[model samples]
Target: MEHEEEEDRLSNLPKIILHNILSRLPKKDGARTSVLSKAWEETWYTFPILYFSDGLFVGTFPQPWEGFLRKRKNFIDYVKRTLLRFYDNGLAIKQFKLSVNNFELHYMSKDVDHWLKLASECGVELLELCLPDGPDQDEEGRGECYVLPNGVIEVKSLTELVLMGGIRVDTAFMNHSIKFFSLKVLSLWAVLSRDEHAIEHLISCCPLIEHITLKCCSVLIPNVATNFLLESDTSGVMKSLNMHGLLKLKTVDVQGIQEVYIDAPCLEKFCYCPGDFDAPFKIDFDRCQNLKYLDLLSLKSSIITDKWFLELFSKFPFLESLKLNNCRMFERINISSVQLKVLELSNCSNLKEVNIDAPNLLSCVFYGGGGSEPIISFLRSSSQLEVDLQIPIDYLDLCNLRESLQNIKPQNVLSSLSLFIFQPTEDALNPLVFQVSSPPPSIKHLHLRSVPKNEILFSSVVNIILSSCCPATISLSFNPFFCTKAFIEFLYETLMERKEDGCFCGSGDTRCWWHGLKDVKVTSSMKIDENVDFKTMLELLGFGEEISFTLEV
Candidate 1:
């Protein structure tokens, strides 16, 4: 019997549906669909959004300098032709993104200006340009950069503008009469401006901006004392960002800024990372009562004290997530937030005690460094709370590790524990010893990562970890420089070969945790290999960066 022919329902779908499908696909894949049929070719032309990158046009293999230049030229021509097609057809471009790397700004400045003019004429709503500095960029970053044209700023239809890398906002920007009146989002990364007023003018023009990100953006101030200075003293970097009445702003992320004054009442998230740690840092959120997420990094102990945290929680009552990194806190601080769900603390060395009373918290992650361990106490937390602790283990200091682990309250559920083992100094020939006073807490998974110099050190480290923690599953990740084959063999021999006789506690104690082990399985990329010898498996699977061993006790 003959089967009925399948209908081409995909191609026959509505244009809007086809456009949606194409939007979900990568730019190259979406453009390739035009070759499928004439109907698709028409749909591709009217797609309304164009994204082009010089990197996408380059081949995977390294090409000669001449070939590279030819490919770059072709990419530029292709972008121009694509934009021209939309302009000629009078179709509104919803979004236009162009990313150029390794291209000299002077060589392509005119072409970039032309492209912007075309996009403006096409009524582009969202415009993104990522033009990284050329190889000739000086250390001071006052080198040649693509000066944003006045035409782009005058585009009243623009709703979102993202300019990254070696772009400059000159003094002309401040004098421009037209502004981005309809813009809702503005992101400037590594963007250079003539002065602080230029940046302030650019932002103040965007009255409807809801989100703003300024990362590593600088202010270039030409040195007047040319005889005394060798080069332009580009030291006038952006020190402060003050947003007075951005009522629509919801998110603000400013890095490399010493001070930030935000008065956005509707702001929901704010992240700030100071440019200089030694410089005096100041931040004031006047009326941001609707904030939900706050992230601060590299703050001094004096800036973030117990009183500061009290004022923070009192000001932003709706904060849900708080992340503090490399910040020095007071000796003891209380984080009493009822709405907090996620809390992350990293390298807060000065914190001796932390009391959290967030009953709605769902997860808390702590990353430790060489500083003294902070005793974290949770007065009230959700029953479903999961705590993740990443602690570094100095081979010479086993007692410190034990003390750090013991500092964690027994009531807190440690879902995952990651131990970063630091190699001992070469002169330290003494064998390290670890004593387990009581049974280790039940951890769902234990991740051990280290770059041991030899197999003997790796074996000793593994034994010490197993003795300290009774984890259901243990994951091992090694550096590629080490011989993974030897490590795997040692692990297999220790966990499987000597399972019945060996005790990880070093002392001959039969009551060890692994004595009741029923089965041991190896998992690679989530696939379990049962009853397999490590030597043979290593030969079959070759060397991988990570390997997991599951213990059935």
Candidate 2:
């Protein structure tokens, strides 16, 4: 009866369904499940997925982690048993994953050999070996290496393979007879040999490759950096995907992976970052039907335009978020995201135009331009947006901005606006007059950076602000440029008098009293030696009662 029931269960499942179910099981667990019933007995043996995790056995017998790792024969025995059991079961594997760690380096090779032998015989499709990510810290890229066993020579079904961290991958290990490999992602910090010919042999052999990632990888005879074709490389090819399966490519993420060929239909998320700027890759995403996210940072060079960016965005049917940074010469971005939530633009010095139509955008930052005019104009179209308009004092243009708030559909639903204005120059006098004319009524937090610097008399300017708007917090950046000995002496003298009168600005007996402003911060660049000025600035702001370190970012 038990024997008949097992046979019935095995016969009921279709081959593909049986393959998927068995794929989820860990190699050890899958093999052991054969004892459950007679149907599973042979099923585990012929299962198509073989997963080997060295971490699993390490965790099974846990002790306090010491820097010292012992060579335990028992540990080796445990892993050997698992590998032999899988080999004995004789399952044809669809995917073989081997993860090696520091603790198992001594004995993992033995167990690894057994696992590969079984996988090769059964035709493993996806072979992956992950070593610890130690390559990042070492300049020489020195770390442990794995040697494949002699019995593991033939794997006719291998497809995707990844070697990361300290995995010592040489030419011979890659010369397997596997074709339909759709992807190969490698993060190589160190190469045992920079043999470009060997690398080429490996890639050329796998014509089915579509996606490849080599973070900080240094290979390719002519250097991958030299592989950029002005329009498209006539030799442009998917190294990992079959030509028959070229359009089936999806995504490629690389480091030092300079240029990539994107002639795929199903390609989705493409993240390519070259740490050095002089060398950059150009991708054509026109045919990619499902492309969603494009994160290109640490990209060294590329001529950028709205048309090129728009062409990239058009590929994704449901893309919502996009971030661009560290890219120079790419100016004028007109954004129109149907479902974008946040748009952040920073440090793109050449970024000039921002024409956005993202109605769903809830937050915006004009961190690039310090003058208040462009950002305020940008937000004028936004109904109620939480904004950080940090405009430096000299060129602030809030002329139409102060009154535009009334036009928002629901007046002032937006929470807060942080404004930074400097008034060190005589030309700053005109904008100072403009500020007092229409002080923001909903101004929640007012940050005054470098307002009282170089012994500059802020007496009149202080009175106008005190009578106009009430601020929650006032911050000061006593910059190094104006932090002189003569400036400090006058500032110290004025601060003592101001504090005695219970106000930062001279006239404070009105509703807009400086006394009401709760937090007052005084800070400078860490390199600046402002020990006397910083101490006295805090005293003047009434923060001497409770010292506070403030930095204007």
Candidate 3:
């Protein structure tokens, strides 16, 4: 009776469902499930997905070279055995992923080639291979690399391909145009090829490819200044993506490219992250009428002036989202997009001011360093606007921050408001707390983030702001390095005093006041002690049902 019940309850799932359940598990775990029953053994053997990571099988390799060699052999043997078992069973694999870190590619190259060829012959649909990435790689290309075999590229059933870290294609395959008959998405990260034109040729050959991401694939010059452009070596191909003749490409992300010349007409979205070199980039967007998003990041020491930035906005009348991050060389950014809805800026160290007149804008985020506070203005009123700002604690001038807040002119039903005070210095505190010039009214949710050392200033600022705006929910990011013992006690005392007496006022000053705040939230990184019972303290204070406490590890 016990055996019958076990079979009915645990082993009754259908074969297809069992196979799917095993497919999602790790390769080792899936193989171990064969000990469950005969039905599970058959299901494990037929599972269609295999993912292997050296980190999962072995911990960080220590100093001894022999230890590394032993672990590397074990990793290789595990993959070989898994693939061999599937091949012997005549089972088709839908996807194969292999990620190795801190492994000598020179010794494992042959094994990798064999595994890829086996996966290709099994009609795999998706293949991903990732290796370690390092900027200190040998310039003369003496480091270990995988020269991908032709079988993997010529696989007729592969629909997605992702290659990362020290990957290259055989020079023999570059002689003729190569195409992936079924590939729709291709991503390359730190991939090296013999010819820069090979990437362009490959994109041209992929008739169905739509999305491409090339991340950190540029080769660096060791002691070169970033202000001047580096000359390209046409004799040898560099690791950069050249977007030409890609008619169907909808999205393109070129990250850390030394030199790029792009002409993708049908692109709907584009992102460019220029590397340290100040090389020239030519992007022809004349035919990208459908383009709606453009992102630029880490363009340090850029030669593009404010005039070019304005021209870019003018060129794409339909652009809806624009994000700029750490793109130096501009002091003032003025954007007037009729259709723009979202704008974000972060870590633009040289930026001093921004004037945006987007009538349709709905949200904006601004974050930067402490050199000088940038003046942000929204010329047109956005009825449904929300803004998130992260500013340096000392860089904030009370008058300027008030002016900037008034510039937005948020509606009565504000979408949201988030303020984070970062990099608190000794100069941040003043004798008297400054009042918010134009306190946001009717904030839906308010978040305040600060370190424990600046708790006094953070609390004083929160008090002044809450005196103006009445937000429905308040969130706090509390670090407990200093205030672990007395943080909750401080909140409890403040809230109880405010609750007992409706508001506070000076003897002869009518302007001094406070609010009857009912809701309180406390999130800390550690719990202090059981003696300080939070629930009992709140109960004694006569507050109920509106308090929340979270302890984060």
Candidate 4:
């Protein structure tokens, strides 16, 4: 009796419990369990979620065309047989995902349409279709794309719909009435539409959509004689996206659109990237008062002025995170907010000064450009605030780096600094004796990354960083093709040879802080015993891509 009890506990589980276990596994893995036992096989056939993709046979084909044809036929036959079995058994499909390349869709569009119709009839709640573009095309210079079937749109059980790449929402959709009554999340990426109104009409019908993403979508509008249509044209791109009265909407990300106007009061996050920077760009979300995150990119300096920031904070009182990228700003800008916590600025090259006064700000990231670093001042800030500075690769000079360190108002507030350095054409790496005038800042960590052509450049970069700041920890990541063994050996030997009374530059200047170093620890993926020799440590690091040195002073 005891042996029988422990024989097969999994097969004795209830059917509902066994089905739940199979639902969490990959489709291939779930199918592999059919040979386990008769009870497990019965549970596998009743799995409600089905996902089919041509990606599984991508690299399996050794001979290009001959192997691809065999893989294609197998994939199609498998999908048809599985769906027919579920249909014959009267089982419900909760979710269905199909991904195929452009080459496969050209010959199997009708098969895809049949599968989608069956999924709709079986009440699929979540449906995702990904058809990426390929090099093959027809005589009209247009790639083959699958037109979305009307039967799929009429499904009242769908709660999430994601369609990406090589899919067309054509005039048939515009003429038919959409009935996506239960959709809550809708994402359309790189989809083509016949006219601008087709996409807008689709969005207006989905009243319950909470999260929406429209990116890289193009609209081909016919030439109309009316002035209203011509005035609103955005060339070949979507002219404008207007979302109003979406009460349940919370998140929206839109890219490659000329103008955007949203009036959703419950919106919490919004990210927008304009299609054309030279043309006039207009964005207004005046009614979204509860927004917490906003990211804008590529806006001109004439649009975002000092007064524009003042109006922005006043409009959205609850915003906590803000990111700006490649958006030109005026000479001076001021950011004063009480609810802001995270701020990031990237390649805003025109600005010369920035004044921040956020008492709750936790972190700020600044990426320097080719010009001089901006003067950053914190009038009022949190006591635990941290700052990150990223120096550009082209501006990686000792003088420029030192000037950046001195510009911070309260220099001790900097928590981390990253340097992207390369070897200079001039002979700045020559062994010359230089003296230190003052001690470097107290940085908690310093990260150095390079793709240098040789080991001499790597050594020079490390020497320049040590002279800049005295970080407690130094992390280095470099090209793997370089002499890793030699670099590690050089680093280990130099750190162990430094004496408490010796100076790095050999200038007899005791002011250098490294003279007081007590110990150095090197860390990598492989473990190193404290009793390990120098050669053993180098051997361990030969296979590691990144290594860190922790200094004890």
Candidate 5:
């Protein structure tokens, strides 16, 4: 009689709380709980996320992995019991993950279709079906796309979907009656484009999609990105997308794509790059109002001129961060991003000068592809309203920077600087001439690539920086010639002593910008700089590296 009363109390526990507990346990173990009695029998089915690995089930089965999985689901009565209980719980599933590798091909796609259909019927929101290996039997010379039935694609709530390596994947589902699918993220891999209209048909049906990522899928120029439109009359929101390795793509018809408008009011970031520079393409996001971040590998403007830059910025009113890399024909860059903060220009072949005018600018770096002369000229000519400038030491101005040091117009703000000093020229010409022109008011990081000549030996160069910028912490680039133990020790002690003198050690309220350089980062390419490690610099900077600092949102 006491036992009966205890069972009654267990049965009366809140269903929602019990469901959470069972969902957290291994599916197989959770199934065993159903055997506790009839009341527990119906609890397993309520578990929303079912993680069943075929390798896991093989341990309980009498036969090997393939034979066990090929058999009926009920053959392993425990797993069957778990699923039965899971189904009886009447809980809508949010995510379903099947962790199985080398899935036995002895089982046909029909078998997979059955289980996935069960998940579809249960309304799983995220279906991550991953088959890392392709089928062992090589029938088709090329990979084949899936020929899915109409019933499987009908899951209305599924927003995130990943399909990689199983059958060939052709997105014919694009032309299907796609309904109730407000899918936000879609990742497709190894899919070919034999059909002429495959890409266009697939994207047209996605009524509400924000992001698209394509990787490892090699194809011809059949599906061009320029053909898609963001029409002024249309009401659609697609904000973020990543397209990589569409190798042969030759052109993008921006005029046609302009008609298919963006519906995402909050769209901020986009990454799209034509694999080749000469690959015919056109990019026009004129209608996209709220775009903030753009990572364009190659902007194939017919001619890159000053007028073209102004027109591009005119389209993107709120553009902040712009990255231009590997563009050979791009000679002059005139950027007028009103809200721009971080500008990273790397490996622009013909890039001669940069004209940047932004009030709230924080950081700027130019990794000139062996073209330091043109960059230095721009640094000297640009407006010096006390902005933080990081240049290859060959380019800095010594005298002018030192004069403006103490009472910077934006008095409280610290204009942090980073220098990459090239080996001094063979003549009396010191690349340090640039340093004399623009003395860094509050230099934080100094990365020296090649040591200056004996005339401007390492110590004298260090003295010049200490006199000009007064950095709180410093990082010297590691090189075979200058990377000796004795030199590092002397440098460390000198920086520590100077830091104690209260030069760059503190600049009140300037923490907003220079804080990222709290200690110092001495990035090396190949060899080890065993002499002065980053930890040694952190010790001098007075901040323990172990404590983590969190940024307030």
Candidate 6:
């Protein structure tokens, strides 16, 4: 009888341990465990997380109109029954995740509201609700918006709230309502606000919110300025999203916003993507002393002048990483920030000159194409630098290109140099081929892509570059039509010729350059009618054994 009692004790785990085990299992699997014995029946009911997703009940009905409706109804009934069982058992729910893809919100609005209230009463800490498109969709099927009810926002026990779908926030519920004292993270996707104040009031209530992500949201009005947008401007016109009082907030990611006023002193990271239509954004950093990472993209109208740029760096003295994309404001950019480590500038059409004086910099990338070449200079030698040139075919001139290449100073630390040249049929390569000078000796990787007719020019360019830099790896991206076995053989012959011409290591050692080439990658997915296997061809040519071939089809 003592042995039997010990076995029973082992089978009957403590309530806390049993609840934890069941909570980690899928809802259905955990519930099915109740069939094992009466001892396990109550364990499933007390499971903290109740995740009811319609996807779990897929294929329950036939693929037809009636079947679709039946499945949605069954999902609703299952969730209702599950929540009711928890209530009947007097169990508390700590987390809840609900996803309904097909249910009509107008018919099930009452049920959703009741479920939220039940979850709140059960002390739910994490709530995730994904509803279908809006109840009142337009005739074009373009609008899929859902309005969130008050019970979800008023849940004081919620620590993390993620509301997706075209949900509209009812600001009226925020006034005189209970604050979310415990809420720390809020994520809203395609959420529409009734007015700007509604969002402001909602944010004021969540004083503990640390991370906020607003993607494809509209009608965010600022309290400091009356320049507000109407609810009808669904074209993603965001006036302002002020971060004034939430001192504990750390990271904010916002897209499709026009203007943002940030005053949070403790903010560490910020990502902003401005829309097509935007006013000049105003950002004051009197309090944001802890700001570190910033990414700004799609700056169409809001140009950053030299003075404004200096002021920005001064305000955020501790910023570490900065990225600017498609911003066409400053013709000349000069930055001298000590704390900056990584800097990237891309697609700045009007930018002509860039001078950086960051001592702690580690990585820098510049993308300039189809315009007058920009002059880039680094005051201090830090580490890796990548220069990518995508000059247009119409503007392909050897003199201008040579001048642009000469403008970049102190090229001893460049790691990768990539050039994409597009030459028209009428353009002659003789001028550019001879003018193409050698690259920096420190470059370790070189990539070249050009039109098939300009193969000789590219070959000459590559030879010049390899003669100077002698990179260990070379990658060639080409149309399959031109990248035949003969073309690769020609490249091999060129490298051999360079080896014989005393171009290897300046010591006249033939084994230094060609033998040192370690990797050759050819990326071409297009099917070539010509039958050519790169591996067999390279082997037949007696390329060194140490060379590895990467032929991606």
Index of the highest-TM-score prediction:
1
Per-residue lDDT of 440-530 in model 2, one digit per residue for the tens? 3444544444343434444434443433334443333444443233433443344334453534332333332433444434454343445
True-vs-predicted CA distance for residue 219, candidate 2, Å: 2.7
Candidate 2 wrong stretches, greater than 4 Å: 1-72, 91-97, 103-111, 119-127, 132-144, 147-160, 168-177, 181-212, 220-245, 277-290, 300-321, 329-333, 336-353, 359-553
Better of 4 and 5 by TM-score: 4
Measured against the true structure, the TM-scores of the candidates, in listed sequence, are: 0.88, 0.48, 0.78, 0.87, 0.55, 0.69
lDDT of 5 by residue, 114-228 (tens): 6567667767777766554432243443322234455645788787665554433344554465653555566555333434345445544455555655544432233245654
For candidate 2, which ten residues in a row score worst on lDDT?
A: 229-238
Ranking by lDDT: 1, 4, 6, 3, 5, 2
Q: What TM-score does candidate 5 reach?
A: 0.55
Best-performing candidate as measured by lDDT = 1
C-alpha RMSD values across all candidates: 3.8, 13.9, 6.6, 4.4, 12.0, 8.5
lDDT of each: 0.78, 0.48, 0.65, 0.77, 0.49, 0.66
Which residue pairs clash in candidate 1? none
Worst 10 residues of 6 by lDDT: 544-553
Instruction: Provide the clashing-pair count of each candidate structure.
Output: 0, 18, 0, 0, 41, 3
Clashing pairs in 3: none
Question: Which candidate, 5 or 6, would have the higher TM-score against the true structure?
Answer: 6
Query: Judged by lDDT relative to the true structure, which candidate is superior, 3 or 6?
Result: 6
- Worst 10-residue stretch by lDDT in candidate 4? 226-235
**Candidate 3 lDDT over residue span 1-553, tens digit each:** 9987887666668877887787678667878988888878777767788888888756764557777778878999999999988787777888999998767666787899899988888889999999765333345544555677877768999988999987765456554555786898999988765555666676677877889988766432323454432222112225355667777789988876666666667788888876555555444555677788988887665554678768877777788998888867577777887898988887787776677788888888777564455767677847776776665443244324334344344335244455544444677565235444333455566554443355565455545445544556554443444222244455545655565233433343443324435455453323344355665544333211223332111
Q: Whole-model lDDT for model 1 versus the true structure?
A: 0.78
